[model samples]
Target: MITLDNVSKKYQTRDKGWFTAVEPTSLHINQGEIFGLMGYSGAGKSTLLRLINLLERPDTGKVLIDNQDLTAMSEAQLRQARQNIGMVFQQFNLLSNRTVAENVAFPLEIAGWDAAKIAQRVQECLEIVDLTERAQHYPAQLSGGQKQRVGIARALAPNPKVILA
Candidate 1:
């Protein structure tokens, strides 16, 4: 489960003013459920998603995933916790030098999975995203959509409990 308790975020503008990105809000997402946020540009959709994974720290409130408060975790603890929370970025942040398969295997590697296991999981995830044929290709070699698929495969490689895309 994911819970946001009166969460809010604000940023300081260049003019030394404040811009409220997210208003104080509370939300709950049960296990095995799919939830989406929708709005116009600059509507805090991205901010809200980033808050869930602590990519952007909340100015107020707590971010809890599977009953643990992410905001309270130490850096090392948070790094461990983040393994179970995958994120597919809008920009498809794949390593230009790494092949698709290697990119997908990246998370499993960070999680300390052995080579054989990582290989198997990477293949499975690539298949799921229908990027198996592009596995040996580098990010730069793939089209935009293919790059996005590689990002999806990478996110799924860890079999994360919560995925923010």
Candidate 2:
């Protein structure tokens, strides 16, 4: 379902100049399978994930999701394609200003879903993560696990096909 062809990422630093974060790595992730990228903290695992989501462009090679070359897509096209992908961060990046329900509805807002539809989806997602009762609570009010659950709900709000967490 996902293919990385000779992907490499490089970063330019002020003092260090250009450094290769990820080498020419080729990987394939099939449908209905679990894949793991294990390495040390600075081992480029997170960089690879960023490449998959197009949050960070690869220096060389290509990223293909379901056979569509994302590296060749336009900015608008890439944005649309990213709707099918969901991501959760290890830091649980929840909006402190919004309630749980509103946080879950943020992506739907960007996708131009109507109020009624967003409300319905947000409710369903909160219920899925067992946070329906806390829908009105802000992120600061929740524990670490609860905050992560809200993040998961927000990420899943768009009904994505691939989840990157």
Candidate 3:
């Protein structure tokens, strides 16, 4: 389960004023459920999603996943915790020079997976996103949709328990 307890975020503007990106909010999303946030642009949708994974830390309240409080975790603990959470960004953040397969293997490599295991998982993830045939293609060579698929493949390579897209 994902729980946001009165989470909020704000940014300081160049003019020395504050811009509230997310107002105080609380929500819960249970496992095995699919949820969507709908609103006009700048409605804090992306901020909320980032809060869930602590890519952007909340200024107030707590973020919990399956009863673990992400907000209170130490940096090292948070780094380990993040491996179980995956994110696919609105902009595909693939490395321009890395091939699709290499992109998918990036996280696994960071987590210290052996080469053979990384290669196997990369192939599996690529197959899941139907990008196996494009494994050798660089991000610049792919169409937008294909690049997005590569991002998805990369996010899935770790078999994350929670995926925020």
Candidate 4:
């Protein structure tokens, strides 16, 4: 489960002074449930999601995952914690220079998996997203939808306990 306790975020705009992106808000998301945030442009929807991943730090409160306080974790601890919390960005952030299989294998490689295991896991994830045929293709070689599929494959390669896609 994920919990946000009175979380908020603000930014200093170039001409508008301080802008509040997210106000003090609390939320709880249970395991195995699909939750979504919907809003018009500039409505803090993205900010709210970013806060859960600690990509945007909440100025007012705690971010907890499975009851552990993410806001209080050290940088190293946060990095380790991130391994189990997968995310697929709205922009589909695939590495341009890497092949689809390489992109999917990247996180597993960082986690210190052996080559054979990495290959096997990459194949498994690709099959899940039905991107197995495009595994050898580069990001530029695939269409936008295909790129998004690659992003999904990469996000699943870690076998995360919580996915933020």
Candidate 5:
């Protein structure tokens, strides 16, 4: 479970203007349930999500994940905790120069997985997204949906518990 209790974020401009991005917001998300944060651009949805991951610290209140306070964790602890959360952008950010397999292997490489494990995971992820046949194909060769599928596969390769869309 994830809980945001009276969380808020503020940005101070050079001109001494204070912008309140996320107000004192409180929310709860249950495990095994798909929760969504929806809004138009600049509605602070992204900021709220960032707060949950401690990508940006809240100015007030707390962010708790699975009953553990994420806001109180150290930077290293936050990084480790963030591993269980996956994020996908609206734009499919695949590397055009790399093959589908390579793109899927990127995250594993960042997490310091061995080459053999990377290869195995890439294969499994590709299969999960029904893109095994397109393993050697570059992003340019695939359709938009196919590219997004590759992104999803890459995000899931780490076995994240929470997916931030």
Candidate 6:
């Protein structure tokens, strides 16, 4: 489960000085539930998601995943905790240099899985996304949907419990 308690975020701009991206907001997403935040562009939707993952630290409030306060976690602890969370970006941030299989294996490698284990997990993830046949293809060689599948596979490679996409 995810909990955001009175969370707020702000950013400093060159000319604007300070811009409030998200106002004080509180939300909770229970386990096994589908949650959606809808808004027009620049409405802080992406910033809110970034705040959830600690990719952008909030200026106020707390983020708790299964009762562990993400805002208070040490950097190492945060890294480890993040392994249980997964993310897929609409932009499909695939590494152009790596093949489809390599892209899927990246998260496993980062999580310290052995080469064989990474290979196995990558295969499994690719199978889940139906991308096994495109294992050797590069990001540039794939269609938009295929690239999105690669992102999904990469997120699933670590077997995360919570996915924010």
Candidate whose TM-score is highest: 1
Candidate number achieving the greatest lDDT relative to the actual structure: 1
Candidate 6 segments exceeding 4 Å error: none
After superposition, the stretches of candidate 1 with alpha carbons farther than 4 Å from their true spots are: none
For all predicted structures, in order, the TM-scores are 0.98, 0.94, 0.96, 0.96, 0.84, 0.95
lDDT for each candidate structure: 0.93, 0.93, 0.93, 0.91, 0.87, 0.93
- The digit string of per-residue lDDT tens for model 5 on 37-107 reads 78889989888877888878999999988888988988889878878887665677888899999988887
- State, as a TM-score between 0 and 1, how close model 3 is to the true structure: 0.96
Model 1: residue 71 alpha-carbon error in angstroms: 0.8
Residue 42, model 4: Cα distance from true site in angstroms: 1.4
* Candidate 2 per-residue lDDT over residues 30-121, each given as its tens digit: 98778888999899989999999899999999999989899999999999999988898888888889999999999999999999999999
Query: Candidate 5 local accuracy as lDDT?
Result: 0.87
Scanning candidate 5 in windows of ten residues, the lowest lDDT window is 83-92
Error of 1 at 131 (Å): 0.8
lDDT of 1 at 108: 91
Alpha-carbon deviation at 71 in model 5, angstroms: 1.6
Higher-scoring candidate on TM-score, 5 or 6 = 6
Q: After best superposition, candidate 4 residue 60: deviation in angstroms?
A: 0.9
**Prediction RMSDs, each to the true structure:** 0.7, 1.3, 0.9, 1.0, 2.3, 1.2
lDDT of 6 by residue, 1-165 (tens): 899999999888999799999999999999899999999999999899989989889999999998999999999999999999999987999999999999988888888899989988888999999999999999999999999999999988898888888
Worst 10 residues of 2 by lDDT: 28-37
